[model samples]
Target: MLEYAPAPESRSVVQIAPSYGLFIDGDFTPGKDVFKTINPASEEVLSEVALGSPEDVDRAVAAARRAFETWSARPGSERAKYLFRIARIIQERSRELAVLESLDNGKPIKESRDVDLPLVAAHFFYYAGWADKLPYAGFGPSPRPLGVAGQVIPWNFPLLMLAWKIAPALAAGNTVVLKPAETTPLSALFFADICRQAELPPGVVNIVTGAGDTGRYLVEHPDVDKVAFTGSTEVGRQIARSVAGTGKRLTLELGGKAANIVFDDAPIDQAVEGIVNGIFFNQGHVCCAGSRLLVQESIAEQLLASLKRRMSTLRVGDPLDKNTDVGAINSAAQLARITELSEIGTEEGAERWSPECSLPDRGFWFAPTIFTGVTQAHRIAREEIFGPVLSVLTFRTPDEAIEKANNTPYGLSAGIWSEKGSRILAVADKLRAGVVWANTFNKFDPTSPFGGYKESGYGREGGRHGLEAYLA
Candidate 1:
């Protein structure tokens, strides 16, 4: 048996100032208010960040508007060079960014290092190639830039989400004023530095750090020509209402409650690993997390036993620890929501179980949990928990699994686990999700588009479709 060791990643490589300000135009300016962003792993205040006001949002939009004239008129080939530069810089600084992400976002170091940072760099690289290729992208003969993009991203996968919004926006030739989530603003501030390092044109990209109201002001600003948001469905609805009749182009990548369906003929061991990755990865903060596990009734007992054995081996603790498979919950409020939904699941008659896992006392932590005997009507099954909690349900047939999987209001993503290629295709086609995976869950790529249907929000956020939203 392979022995494990504590190999904590060093945090000294990354530096965070005591306080930060709004990155407007090309400078970091003071704000009227400031709020502390804390490390969710230890509840330690990492730094004080600016809380942007309506006036600040106005200034940012104005700066972007001014820059947009020169920025948009620049040749697409020239813009591609800048994008390529930024991508290279990101790759160079990846280790620093990865450690910082683990600190600020409370995800395991392995995830931040391996999954998030790589994808962030990949997104920029992918979009950079598209900068000079828009005419060939089928968006009419000469697609034009939308003046200024107002973007808001969620706390989960902060840097990657920023890349998703900013990369395509810049590739399509739009300037941006983005508001990072209040709890996880440090990475965005660092990204502002990345823009400066790339010598990106002033006001071509801006970062405003604050809570919900700050996002509202940025998205609602009249000078803003495009709005892109990735967060909860509730907030997406509000943004939709605010942008209605405002003549602003809008795209939302909202909430999800994806299903991972496992058939009797499937590889049980591989399915178990995928199930673990689906809901437990990043503490289930993923919007497209496969929170609902639908297993065939025939293999329920066998699969459950194997899953429990694997769950028992998961190492949960510090985010920087290389051995940690799961880390802290992003915040106390998020932990509370996870707890509430879990308790409600028990009250509603689902059997709840969790492997024995020790958690640090100072952090917001929830041990990886699973609820068996879950029904479609259970709140845990219906709503997005956004935590390391999985709800398991059994289905006798493929059609029954399909019915239960589509029972939720979310249609962001789904997964099919079957050895049969025909069965995978049939099930994936029947699923009402925007993205589907066969024998895998929670996989993403820059070349492929991703978004959702129904209440999960409208419009795509990757590939050529992502660039289209930032263009005329």
Candidate 2:
């Protein structure tokens, strides 16, 4: 187990609020039901956050609906200016935001700083440029905003996900009522303060934090014109079912079991690095994590050996530590899901290998794990474990690789590795996934369109396609 010491620099970022409440109509107000947020690294109580009910959702929707009439009618250039101000404020407070994200979310400070916070700002900056350019986006002679959008995001990338949800809605001139996941609501609460700093119009963006009930309320509220969600495939189906006859515009970015294909001709060291990053980044809590590895049969043994050696060097400890590569699991419920799926892997006769890692007594932790001899039917191969668990399978040829990659019901993302550029392009074209990386995995850009096909859910969250979900 690794020891932890508080950093004075990080502690100074934001004072922990005594009691967090719903951010409705540009103010914090109490809710009838409340839930506690915990630090996943140590399983310590961080704070209690208000859990809004259907009535609270109604109030937020009303606030957003009321604001939309005026906010959406404002000049496009003026809207762009507000987005620019927000982008500037986020840049100024990037360090503070990164530290708070690490403290509350159990992702390494390095990732929070280098990945999440920067992407959040980039997303805002990217969308700001589109505020006045919607006429050129092929919307119509004159595009218009959806009155009020209801958004629900997952816990994996809290603030970044918030940016994905809010920036495009605001850029499209839609007011928003967003719900941050119950366990990771602190950063969203802090972000509400950022909106105030930017002087964003009252009720332009309201955050109501809670669990499934809160999300259901927000999605089902008649006042909401659109619904956006990012989470599990099962829940995505449920949301689809619930909104079936309502005619509400809906978009879902759900679960994935992406394949990382390694060809024999690839650079072994770089491919190994990409493979590690594919499954281990953010402790593999990503929606499009490359959890399934399909190695060319000729190099399967060599790749497995190299991957295990690389896994041995990863530092798993306090997320605040700069040296840590893999941090604690997001929450107890997630840890249980990882554990259950891993057991299923063993029972189905796959070989499971985990480093001899000692974990902290209090936090939810799981070591980097790999399963060999995994077949397509294995639960580990088919299910979304949502943890640092990788399953290894082998393919004899490029066609077999493409077949194995697309075998899963998920079509979110996939990766291809090869020295030949033509081969990479050929395989990339054949795979049935939304995002395909020729030589990388888990790479993201705010200007790029991202979403999934089939059961992985629909609707793009970034680029010009993002505005489609929020526009009339």
Q: Give per-residue CA lDDT, model 2, range 177-224, as digits (tens).
A: 999988899999989999999999999999999999899999888888
* Per-candidate local distance difference test: 0.93, 0.91
Clashing pairs in 1: none
**TM-score of each candidate?**
0.99, 0.97
Give the clashing residue pairs of candidate 2, or none: none
The TM-score, computed over Cα atoms with residue i paired to residue i, of candidate 1 is: 0.99
| Predicted structure 2: clash tally | 0
Per-residue lDDT tens digits of candidate 1, residues 1-472? 3568889999999988999999999999999999998999999999999899998998888899999999989998899999999999999999999999999999999999999989999999999999999998888999999899999999999999999999999998999999999999999999999999999999999898889999999888888889999999999999999999989999999999999999999999999999999999999999999999999999999999999999999999999999999998999999999999999999999999999877888989999999998988899999999999999999998999999989989999999999999999999989999999899988889999999989999899888888889878
